[model samples]
Target: MASYHRVLEVFDRSVQDKTLECAYDLDPWDILIDDERWTGKIRLFGFVDIFFLICYSGEERFEKGIIIYKDNDSVRIILERARKNTTEYVVNRDALENEEIPKSYFSFEDDKGGLNYQILGLGHPIGLSTNYDPGSLKQYKIKIRRSDDLVTRKRMQRGLKQHTLIDLMLDVVRLGIITSAELISKVVTMTVAGSATDDLARKYLQVLSGGQPGTPGLSRDRM
Candidate 1:
């Protein structure tokens, strides 16, 4: 067995200000072993979602969270996680640049015939650029897999329904159909009336309602 180590560096910027607010260096994370493959699902912010399945035969390393795939004789199968109701296969740059690599290795099939495991990637605070220069800085990513079954699929569907409800509520507020204060009050009241454990949700509502004082109305223009 070949031992591999990898590292990843992440840069986080505020979408509102477009300013680099934080940076992180994560080290000694997970490694992809030879002949082992995995698949998994990701639920973010209760709305953003992705379902993926992958199979690979390779040895890779992470050093301080920077990504480095050491073995040239590696093959990977990747299913692009779906977002906004779109999904596809993901091709690694290495596979694209190397003529020896065949595109079929990364192909994705919708049929549930193969291994269905969850591969959970390490989560960092930054979004990486697809066109990044690897020579100047190394990039690292992680994947986690779980067995895909009817139960997990149903859970993901439920999450999507809830996310849609929340989005509709926010849209109403954005369109000025309802005041931010009204929305905040409703959320706070419902939360307080039901489960008091969701302090984060309450705080988020407060932030939305307590915008800069004297602002005329809730407008997506300001967001």
Candidate 2:
């Protein structure tokens, strides 16, 4: 259990800029910690310190993501541990406001080679929503209506697409078709055309290629 105060102090020093230090102001955002769901705003008093570290030494480092100071006398810190300068994190499920759908819903064989569209309802009739077995399919659906503002609609669309891609990657890993490292590499290749996964894909690529100084690596606790 790392102390929140220590984490904050180290983070403040890392930023160096006086204007970038944490002020402890609560700014709300939905975040996922490991497998648990948490809803809260960040406590950034000034500049948004979206990234920080709890510990770092000799090529081993633990990066902090969302720090939720719950009123229940407990603090939830999303951590990503990397050893020997590797780009991988220890727990890897960090997507804000996104729910994890069970991997069982995606059935695949080692030789299957790619996603099964029939099972995923990829070619289903346009007007009809695809339905999976009850209790088998669990995902967060972003309902966008015509009445939604432009920004809201765009955000929902981005979220929905990102959710779908994450599910696909998870399914690939779950089926043993590819290791998580391979999946990340594949995603980077696939996203060269550009998509919601571009930022993350690029990060993984940097890690795989031996990260440059000052570049952030992928966290196990991030999506």
Candidate 3:
């Protein structure tokens, strides 16, 4: 498996201004992390997760904490634990409901799904470009199947044994980097909790295209 390090792209003020990514396959860095944790939840509709982190702020060089984007009610335990490490921090959500969810929670927008990664943005971060998103005819079936395949794919890769491919995809979209089959494949393989499986990737692409593999015209093999 390939290893890569990414910066934390904070689109909202709710999150800290530090770069937050996985620690595996990372090169030695000057940044010092005081605390870090990862937790995930599986649901019928979709998955939910929390990553409570605290670190020495690179800008000021002092201890600071970070809160998950979840509602303060849902992340009370994590926030408490994280606070044990630092007094000053950015809690994405705390014991407040009416409180505005920091725009940091989401990234920029994408016309493809009409979903924003951060929140407000002019256009999609990673351009859909000339390529096409598997149309609606196959979107539902493909997303469900693809989401599952993603879970399996993350399991095969090393060091990425915690988050799902969707996490990587979200991060990429937030970063506004290029998103291609090769790029997505390489990065997802590096960060997910499982090993990379070409067969699984193909299965998802095929389903997305609404066509079976080994058939011509529906899907292309390369990015």
Candidate 4:
């Protein structure tokens, strides 16, 4: 199993600069491994949303999305694998249904008469306050408001970077414990041999608890 101390030492070395910019403390190691909440959730979705008129929703394209693998080391491995698997989203009409979109927030009235009788998109009756199924448009309003915040985007971006870091950490953990311990040892430690055979099997549990590195490819367990 990879030890926390072992990986932390390596991470500290990689992010040796101590100031990661986005970090309020300006410390490179501000990214904490002991965070009780999973930072991955924030990265799974973008901070700001774009609202659009009924005109268009763009063409079909491959987009990045998130998928959870496991709560531990395997989650990291699967996330790493997924970075290569961009998802396909179709731009069909149904795709534009009521969901809050990116960068297209505005009231789009269809000008049938080009006057007071102009129709709202998808038969939304004219109203002072939104009294729709979403109820007061509270969620959409919040999404738009939150998305507009600069700090919100910063948090989202940082969360994404860490998400990928966690993935690489998972792969390193798996290699050092499950798939190719011998391979990783070549880079970090061949001197990492177990004192007892019983110690070798117990290594995986330790790796499972491993977290993201402060620097890109550094590991909590070093290699």
Candidate 5:
């Protein structure tokens, strides 16, 4: 499994000064995820932040955090953990000229019939390409599978786990019974617990898990 840090990096870049400042900021701009069909202004329906509580060992670690962006039609997932930067970071280059550096990815389905979609980043920094090479930005495509619901095409599986988390968090928000943080803490703390070498990570996890140092750590079942 890929490290969540890569996903976080994409989101951190996407939310720069030009990008979304908060969930409400998502509606002002029409996101083009390599698609020309769904051009209408998309609204932010859901947003979730997954932190060190869900992190596990033996996976790539990132520093910042992870976030989920759910719009009117689709959801974008990005994660962050602790890891080294060995790969080239995409910058102010023409996205069309450069191949898409898919650092991290996630997908979502609407309530109706669960239409599957694979969203690709058209520009660097995940989002906030308004000032960047808009003309040169890569085309964001939504790969649609009408018949299949849970089954996804190639490279679509990595996003499955993230999507599940997004769905759960969205439901929690809808229910208004518990906050996403409390719910994740209770669920993850019960399933996994380990050590965090990073000072900040440990402290952050402790806060989420109610100041329990060993409450939250990293562990992916398959990885």
Candidate 6:
């Protein structure tokens, strides 16, 4: 398991100016780790450290989903991950059939604790064909609102059980954890480990590419 102390230590050394702009207090660390409500929630996700409780202030302004990672050159990168996965949205034709869509929240739970991320923005509808049920009718993915939203649909079948790979990729991009250009480069280019590649950079890339790293790969237990 990756210790919180070790993560904070890395964060302390990585910051160029030793200051992270946040909506919290002058010392965001104190409020984040010291407070019981926020303790253990802030953790290493993918190649970056996700401060779930803190709203980050970046090039834009205050944004939700703050992630701290390393740049391609191994510099500390801090940015906000957005709630909506993509801007391209398709209108739902089945308005009468669809129920009220509540907000989406991803809960990361493990032995230590749980962090609930309240997904921002009104969700945009997109279709992903599934292998389990392959057909024209299965081409369109079920709407993902709240977990309960699926309870009433399709004879009260299962709801959104997991986040898709595309969803995770968009998350990092939207949050500014990794830029589109950076993402593209990582995907196309072959990465060599050790002195040749940035470990943190590789971790985020690995995560977006749907591979789990040895250390703190979005697993709460590892965190």
Quantify all predictions' global Cα lDDT against the true fold.
Answer: 0.26, 0.28, 0.26, 0.24, 0.29, 0.26
lDDT of 2: 0.28
- Model 4 segments beyond 4 Å from truth? 1-73, 76-146, 160-223
TM-scores for all candidates: the values are 0.20, 0.19, 0.18, 0.16, 0.20, 0.20
Error of 2 at 151 (Å): 3.4
Q: How many backbone clashes does candidate 1 have?
A: 34
Highest lDDT against the true fold, candidate: 5
How much does candidate 3 score in TM-score?
Answer: 0.18
Candidate 2: tens digits of C-alpha lDDT, residues 100-145: 6211211112112331111110100010111111112122211112
Of 3 and 5, the candidate ahead on TM-score is 5
Candidate 4 lDDT, tens digit per residue, 1-223?
A: 3322222232221112221212121111212212222222111221111111111112312122111111222222322322311112111234356455421112222223422111111111111111122111111111111123468445533322322334444544543534555545442432355233233222221122223432122112312
What lDDT score is found at residue 52 in candidate 1?
16
lDDT of 3 by residue, 120-156 (tens): 1011111112222222111000011111244433322
Which parts of model 6 have CA positions greater than 4 angstroms off? 1-7, 10-23, 26-48, 52-183, 189-198, 201-223
Clashing pairs in 6: 80-175, 81-175, 82-175
Better of 4 and 6 by TM-score: 6
State model 4's lDDT. Answer: 0.24
In model 3, what lDDT does residue 77 have?
24
RMSD of each: 17.9, 19.6, 21.8, 21.3, 18.4, 18.3
Give the better candidate number (2 or 4) by lDDT: 2
How displaced is residue 152 in candidate 3, in Å? 30
* Residue 91 displacement in candidate 4 (angstroms): 20
